[model samples]
Target chain A: MKSRLRVLRAERGWSQADLAERIGVSRQAVNALETDKHDPSLGLAFRIAAVFDRAVEEIFDNPHRTEGPG
Target chain B: MNPFTTGPASREYQLATAGWFTLYGVILFTVAWAVDGRGLAAPWVYPAAVAPALPIAGFLWTVLRFMDRSDEYVRAVLGKTYVIAVHLTLLLCVAWGFLEVYAGFRHLALFWVFPVFWVAVAVTGRFIRTTR
Candidate 1:
């Protein structure tokens, strides 16, 4: 899944480690999520959203949702 | 330091693994001394032979506990690595079995399977991407 995690983290002046600490995961996990190498689980996505004070959809682009009819 | 190894869960897993492996070595040595040096009799030797396996089970339990306590990405990466390691170990052992039967290869001890699986895990983990 595509994510704006890098952008979001950058805007907040947070390093990968900073964001990872906030989300209770390793920095590598933050990098993986930012690079689209791994998709976060629902719980992790919620946690990330909570950390950023945004909606999950705001961070992650839902490909399935985009494929549906308007 | 690897981020995966920095957490409390990792520390606990490491300690548990060390404890279990140490126990395994001690039990194995004691059993060997009893059976070979002291001429331990039959029936009793059976349980003695099986004693070392308990610590191996404990070692596996530590891995499970570590995975349960890890974050989602670490758990996912480790889960995949273990699956790959299991398949690799199975393939190697099966091929060796066939070779021993048909090609005059020497028989390998079954206890080697545990170490072989860990070797496979190390190799697969080296090549597998844990991060981007």
Candidate 2:
């Protein structure tokens, strides 16, 4: 799963630590998420989206998983 | 009062960091006693032996306070490890009981139970945090 968290956070001029503190997680976790080293669970995704005031889908997208051919 | 409501990692890190202070005390005490050969005569020996335990207890309390808020995955991992520890403890206890019953062994050391429980919790916590 790839996410726009980095871009979103950057747009808001927020450092990873700032975002992590706002989201109630360790800064390392935020770094892991931004680097695609870790995938956020649904709850975490929702929280991230809430922090950005954006839809979860806008922040997260599963590119590798494709829909079946019609 | 509650570490979990504040921050889990922060509390864990704080307690672990403070544990080093107790470790220092233990090391200093051990060295003094070993070098002087005055373990009994040293008036500080008793306090030195027991002082570190106070910080250790505080560390344990902080860890427990935060651990109670572990996620489901954490809880499951810990629960599994604890189950294994419980089984191991039961096996040891039963073996001792059998020995006492049939082999006429008077008693078995009972101190291993604490290590068994400690190892289970320690390993489980490490596993959950580091697991991919």
lDDT digits (tens) for residues B37-113 of candidate 1: 99999899999999988887797889899988888777887788889999999999999999999999999999889
lDDT of 2 by residue, A20-66 (tens): 87886666567667766567778988888899998887888866548
RMSD of each: 2.5, 8.8
Q: In candidate 1, what are the lDDT values of residues A6-64, reduced to their tens digit?
A: 99999999998899889998876788788787899999999989988988888899887
Candidate 2 regions off by >4 Å? Answer: A63-65, A68-70, B1-12, B15-59, B66-131
For candidate 2, the docking band is: incorrect
- Using Cα atoms, each model's DockQ against the true complex is 0.46, 0.07
Q: Count the clashes in each prediction.
A: 0, 0
State how far residue B14 of model 1 sits from its true place (Å). Answer: 2.0
Give one digit per residue, the lDDT tens place, for model 2 in B70-120. 542333334555566667668777887899999998885564555555565
Cα RMSD of predicted structure 1: 2.5
Candidate 2 colliding pairs, count: 0
In model 1, the clashing pairs are: none
Q: Give the Å shift of residue A59 in candidate 2.
A: 1.7
